[model samples]
Structure formats: structure tokens, C-alpha cells
Target chain A: MSNASTRNRGIPNPLAWIGAAALGLFGEIGRLAVFSARVKAAAFSPRWYIGQIWKQIVQIGFFSLPVVGMSAIFIGAALALNIYQGSGRFGAEQFVPNIVVLGITRELGATITALMLAGRVSAGISAEIGAMRVTEQIDALESLSASPYRYLYAPRFLAALIALPLLVLVADIIGVMGGWAVSVFGLGFDSTVYLRNTLDFVTRNDILTGLIKAVVFGAVIALMGCYQGDRSKAGATGVGRAATLSMVGAAVLVLASNYIMSTIFVEVGL
Target chain B: MTTPILSLQNVEKRFGKNHVLRGVTLDVAPGESLVVIGGSGSGKSVMLKNALGLMTPDSGKILFNGEDVTQAKGKTRARMRERVGMLFQSGALFDSLTVWENVAFRLVNSGVVSRAKAKDRAIETLSKVRLGSDVADLYPAEISGGMQKRVSLARSIISKPDLIFFDEPTTGLDPITADAINDLIIEQVRGLGAATVTITHDMASARKIADEVAMLFEGEIIWRGKASDVDNSGNPYVDQFVHGRAEGPIQPAL
Candidate 1:
């Protein structure tokens, strides 16, 4: 019965299915590249929506502080405790402060903040824009001579690009402080010595690496959200799917890009 | 006759193999209200989108002011869009914005007027539609659907373009509210003196506001005539549709 159905439908071979999937993937990537280029053009265009950009910054950055802060503090405390335990087994408990600061500044701060934002901000943007698309508000904007790329996308893109590094900086400082508190109070370390070691071990290069990663992750989050939302189908289900896809896509892209950037940074001796 | 403000000559559009539009030709003269009536999936929305430059036709010329703008882009498209407005089926008001902001969106965004002045103008426009200023600060969700439709009308006509497209302006409303909206649409379109194209299957609305009526069936304009002549158009499809008869030549899409 399966063979009869396949014969009637003229189904392709497994190799053809693989080829079609590859083609679909490449087509999607090309479309994304084109979308990114259009967004870049719109960003640099003469018309700038400064007010919208400020609004988005306040929404994406200022509103996200509490959650990001809480996550950073907990992660930092956990890392400090784990490092103390592992280093004590090798009689290297004195190195706990250095490693904690190093880890937070170079990796955890930016990655954790981006992943959190990928869940929160990305989904929110997707839902908002997707709702607009389905309800024909985006079409209304177009009819009013407003470009969605300029009005809807560029503002969010600029906001995320400008805001994420600042967020990462705050997360880094808070994380380091959490580590200091844990080491001095919970682990019986000298406060002054831990502070000195943390300050000594963290360099400008370490902070710069995380900030750079934050910038890329920010762009990825906004791009994924806007792209998914703009192409969303018409209806409540469509908008819901777009939001889900935006969150999943942003999270996956953030992690993949983080790995690639880390490799590049290592290769460049950053 | 004067040059048509908008014209579509043999425009066609397709989605893969669906072939939604099949060589549709239409024209809307300045200050004229042309209502295109059709059943669901009859390509009325697609044809309207093509005329509004929201969608491109696969093959044919779309002329605005006698200039072919079938594939216009960037500044040309923007300039064309500035001269046209659309009231979507769902009212499509910006949920984040208040009623006044939604009405004055075009003015403030285009830098044509200051926010204060735009708000004043928005309230004035609202009064034209019989809406009080008390609703200005309220969001679209706070207002009734009929009021939301009024706000959408106000927004579309705020710029006073040369043309307007009303896509099913009275789709989801009670008869009394729908009639009220129809009255407002007639008043507003006449006030703007803009050429208008409205697509709807609502015969009551078509009879109330249409100067000329066109019936679309199977992606083609099957019959067109003056509004009074729509009842006796003699085309089977139009007769079937206008009478809402399910047993005519127009079979249900199963």
C-alpha cells in the first residue's frame, strides 16, 4: 500500500529529499543575508527615528536589568563555590578569586545575559511584530509611507546593539561582586586579598572579549526576532509560532555564534 | 474622459499554482467610488493589494496618474504610497498608540505637522466621524469595534491623499454599526474628494456607498455597471452573489 501511494505521488528518492532539504536551508540563509543587508541600508539612510530608538533602548535595556542582575549574582556565587571546592582538592584554593573573575569577564557574563535576552526580548519583539503583521498594521504603516525596516526594525536593532554591551558590563561587575561576597563571607577568604586578586587577574582584554560577544549576540537576537515576525503567517496561531521560533532560533544562533567568535578570538590571541 | 487616477491593465498574480488573479483590468477615476464585490477567495483582496502597491502583479501594467508604476521601488514607491491610503478589514490600529496618535500617525511620522497640531487635527477629524474627543486618549482595545473602525478611517484620510482603498470596511459589525460605518465612509470619501476602491461582499454596504459596482468571479471582472443597475446586472455570477443564492451557477468551494 505504501509503494502504491508512493508510485501515485511520484515520490523522489532519499537522495533527492536530502538535496531538497539542503537547498531549502541555503535559500533561507540567502534570504536572511539579504534581509540583513536591507536592514543595514535602512540603518544608514538619511531618515532616522531617534525617538523610536530611545524608546526601544529603554524597553530592551532598562527593563531587563533585574532579571539579568539576579541571574548573574546566582551564577557567580555558584561558580565561586565550585571553584573553591575543586581548587582545594589540589591545594590551589588561593586561585579561586582569579579564576572566578576571569571566567565571568571572559565568558559567562555575556553568554548568560544573551541567552536570557534571547528568551525574553526576542520572544517579545517577535510577538509584537507578528501581531502587527497578522492584523495588517504593518501594511497600514506601508500605506502611510513608513518603512517597517526603518520604523519597526532599525530602532530595535540599534537598541539591542547599543544596549547589550552596557548590560554585559553591568552583569560582569555584579557577577564579580557576587564572587567576592561568596569568597569572603561563605568560604572564609580574606576580603582584601580576594579583591586584590580579582582586580589583578581581570584585564581590559577579558572585558573587551565579552563586550564584543555581547554586540554580536544582540544583533543576532534582533535579526532573528524581526525576520521571523515579518514573515509570520496570518492569525493567532501564526503569531504564536513566530514567537516560539524567534526564541528557539535566537538561542541556537547565540550559542553557535559564541563558539565561532570564541574560536576566532583565541586564534587572534585576544 | 479625464485620465484615471489609478488603472490596472491586464494585471495578473499567482501563488505557485493557485493563479489567484487572471488578467484583471480596472480603472478608478478621480472622485469616483468604485466598489468591487466578490465572494471569499475570489481574488478581490489580491487585486486591491496590487493596485495599492502592497503586492506586485505577475504580469500587467499598474498606472497611477497615467504613469506605469508596476514595479516602482524606493522613493518612487514611497511617493506613490503617499498619494494613497487604505482602511484594512480588521481596523489595524496600532495597539500601542492612543486613538489620537493612531489617527495622526502619518502626520507626525512624516514630519508634516507637530505633535500638538496633529493631535488637534486628529480630534477635528474624529469629530467629522462623529467621535468625541473623550476617546482620543484611549487605546484601540478600549473602544468598541465600530469606534475602532472610525479611528482607522480617520487615520487613512488624515493625509488627504488622491486615492483610498477600503478593504471590507464593515466586515465584523452589527447591521446598525455597519450602516453607521458605511455612512461615515461615504461622508469621509466625499469629503476628501479622493478616488476610492472598496472591496466587499456586503451587498448593503455596496448599495449604500458604491457609485459603480464590479463583480469579480473566478479572478475576473464578470460584470460592472452603475450601482442601481447591480440588481439587474443579468450576469449569472453577480445575480447569484447579490442574491446570496447557494443554488445558482456559483457553486460553493468544497
Candidate 2:
């Protein structure tokens, strides 16, 4: 009996372990909420860093153009091929332009562009801020009477907010053109017909909804990167962990928010 | 008696179960330089951070000029910080900015001066730290470690703050560089007449710069006295720490 009792003492209770994990999850959620509120407050307040915001806009939007454009074109091409193959079974291959335009505008353009940024911009922001945190630059800013939220975070937040929608618009145009390329050139379809079908099939609401989603995804990306970076621990390992967490968190939040927003839009007949 | 420019009354801080600071109390008068010496992880940096309002203490009253600014926020905290400067360990210069930009960061960011004037002031401050105007345009990463520290020093004193904190100012440099830094620190603090708190384990640094020397052990100030008395404090802990003895009451961590 004593030997059995000693063995039991070494084992953790499953219920207790689960309870602790649940509490930790809730704690993290609460902290993220507080961080979001703080970012909003900072954005609305005075002492705005306009120069920094402009610089971030150039960094986040201009520099991201090549990658986002590349991804859109490739995804658009592959999407056209797949849709052509899938719809051919029903003897409906002519519907490829309509479906491609619909998918790109209503869902794929914003989502894919956001995911690409989640990999590139989110990781970059987190690593840069995490390095600052570790090296005491954030603390130095505080010492200088400069608010980190105002100087560092609000600029990035506002820049991403302003940049993402514009980027998605470009991505939508390129994506539709990509599908046009694959369908007309590869599948021997008429070019003018494909372009006309795309334009006629897509609606103002479809494009607007994608832009709206881009705004939210942009906020999510910036928030995750800043939050993770600010909370990072000491040293290189801590910085690396922060970057990883920011990318993962941004991607997950973007998808989740996209689903919720899409469901709402559908309910409202958008 | 003049009120202490900075005072920590019964400051306590903890990280989870580890009680990093257990009621640490200290004071620094205006125009005074107080050097705190302690082994690594003795809560020396934590105590300094609490005093600077960077880290809040679990329980304590931090009075700046006899005003309790322990829980100060917003403009009050910003106002408090404006009158203070810090030289961080590893220099902590903004990697993206040139040396002059880093030095003049506060002035330009606060809208206190034009960019041209700020650049001139930054170059002037850099000269005071023995750095030439040519070094002003270089990035922090471009400079040597010792030069980085000097630039950091210049940045700290640019505002001519009422109070300053130096965290491990001489930790990574060679002995010659370290001594030069200590001398510069003394000269600057005297020139500004600022009340300063510096935390370092270097006995030589403490002796050279300290008006009063305090020893923190296990998150408490076990002994404090004049800089001259640090060598013969009659306390075994100070004695052991001063001479660097292995077999003292203070055990080395495994």
C-alpha cells in the first residue's frame, strides 16, 4: 500500500492539469484583449508619429507588393486549372471564368494575401520588436519619456490598417488576370470572353467584402506581432519563440475572423 | 535637511515564488553619486528599475523629491521620466538609427528642436563623451562596444536630467576602457549636478565613482556607508565580497 501511494504521488492528476491549462488559456485571452484596447487608445490619442507611420506604410505595403503579386498569380493559375478539371465532369468548363472571379473576390484574394503577410510581415515585426525588448531599447524609450505604444506600436498598427486593403485590391486584379492567363492561353479559351465573364460575374459587394476582411486581417497581424514581441523573454531563444508565435497566432486569427465575418456577411445577404 | 532626490522605502518585488527584492530601502541626495554593488541575480537591477518606474515594486513608496510617484501614470509618469535618464547595459542604442539620431532622439521626438538643431546638439554631446563628429553618422552596430557605451552615455546626459541610473556601465569593456568610462561618468554627473544611482559588481568602478556605496545581498541592502569605508566595513559580507573570497558566508550558486 505504501509503495502504491509513493507511485501515485509522482503522477499528476489529469483533471488538475486540464484545469491549469484552461486557466492559462483564459489568462492569455484577457491579456490580448487588454493589449488590443491599449492599441486602440494609443491610435486615437495625440502625439502621433506621422513620419514613423509613413515609413511603416512604405515598408508593409510597398515592399510586400512583389511577393503578394507573385502568390496571387500562381494561386490564380492553379485555381483555374483545378476548377476547369473539376467542372469538366459536369460538362460545364465554360463556367471557369465566373467561378474564378467569384472565388478570388469573395474569399481567396484577401485570405491568401493575409496568409502570405502572416508569414512575412508578422514574423518580421515580432523579430524586430522582440530584439528591441531583449536589448532594452523599449526600456530606453520609456526612459526617454516616449510611449512605446505611440512611437512603436500605433504607427505599425495604423500602417497595416491602411496598407492591407490597398494590397488586397491589387491582389484581386492580379488574381483574376492570372486565371485569365491560364484559361485563355493554356485551355484555348477566348481572351475577351474570359475578361467579360469575370467582370460580369463579380459584384461590388464581393470586392467590398474582401477589402473589409483585409482590414480586420491587417489589425490581427499587427496586434499579434506587437503583443508577442512585447511579452517576449530574454535572449535569442525568446526572440525566436516570439516570432514563431506571432506568425502562428496571426494566421489562426485571420482564418477564424474570416470565417466569422463571412458567416455574418452571408446572413446579411452581402 | 534637503529631501532626497530619490528614495525607496521598503520596496519589495517578487517573480513567482522567487522573492527577488525583500523590502529594499535606499536613498540618494541631489548632486550625489551612489553605487550599488551586488553579485549577479542579487536584485540590484530590479531595485534600480523600480526606482526608475520601469518596474513596479510589490510594496513600496518611491518618492521623487518627496512626492510619492509610486503609482504615477500618464502625464505624471511622463513628466517624471523626462527629468530622468538611464545608461543601459549593452548600450541599447537604437540599431536602425545613426549615432547622432539616437543621441538626439528625445529632443526631436518631443518637438523641442528642429532636426538641424538636434543634429548639431547630438554632435556636440558626442564630443563631450570623447566621440568625434564623424562617428555621429555611423550606426550603433558600426561602432566598437566601448564606443557604444560612450554614445549611450552621451544620450543619457543630453537632457541634463535631474536623476540618472547607470546599469552595469562598465561590465563588458576592458579595464582601460572601463576606467575611462568611470572617469567620464564622474565628470558628467558633476557637470550636470545630477543625483545618480549606478548598479555594478565591479569594485573598482564603485570605489572610483561612488560617494556612498551600498551592498545588496539576497534582495536587501545589508550594508551601506561612505565609499572610503567600503574597503573596511567591518561586515563579513562586505569583506568577503570586497576581497572576492570563495569560502565566505555568501555561497556561490551551483
Note the Cα lDDT for every prediction shown. 0.93, 0.94
Clashing pairs in 2: none
In terms of TM-score, the best-performing candidate is: 2
Best by lDDT: 2
Q: Distance (Å) between predicted and true CA of A254, model 1? A: 1.0
Q: TM-score for candidate 1, please give it.
A: 0.97
Two-chain complex of model 2, DockQ on C-alpha atoms against the true structure: 0.89
Candidate 1 per-residue C-alpha lDDT over A78-133 given as tens digits, one digit per residue, 9 for 90 to 100: 99999999998989999999999899988999999999999889999999999999
Clashes of each: 0, 0
Model 2 agreement with the true structure over A86-192: per-residue lDDT tens digits: 99999999999999988998899999999999988988999999999999999999988888999999999999999999999999999989999999999999999
Interface RMSD of each: 0.7, 0.7
Q: List the residue pairs that clash in candidate 1.
A: none
Can you give the lDDT of residue A147 in candidate 2?
A: 87
User: Each prediction's TM-score against the native?
Assistant: 0.97, 0.98
- Model 2 has an lDDT value of 0.94
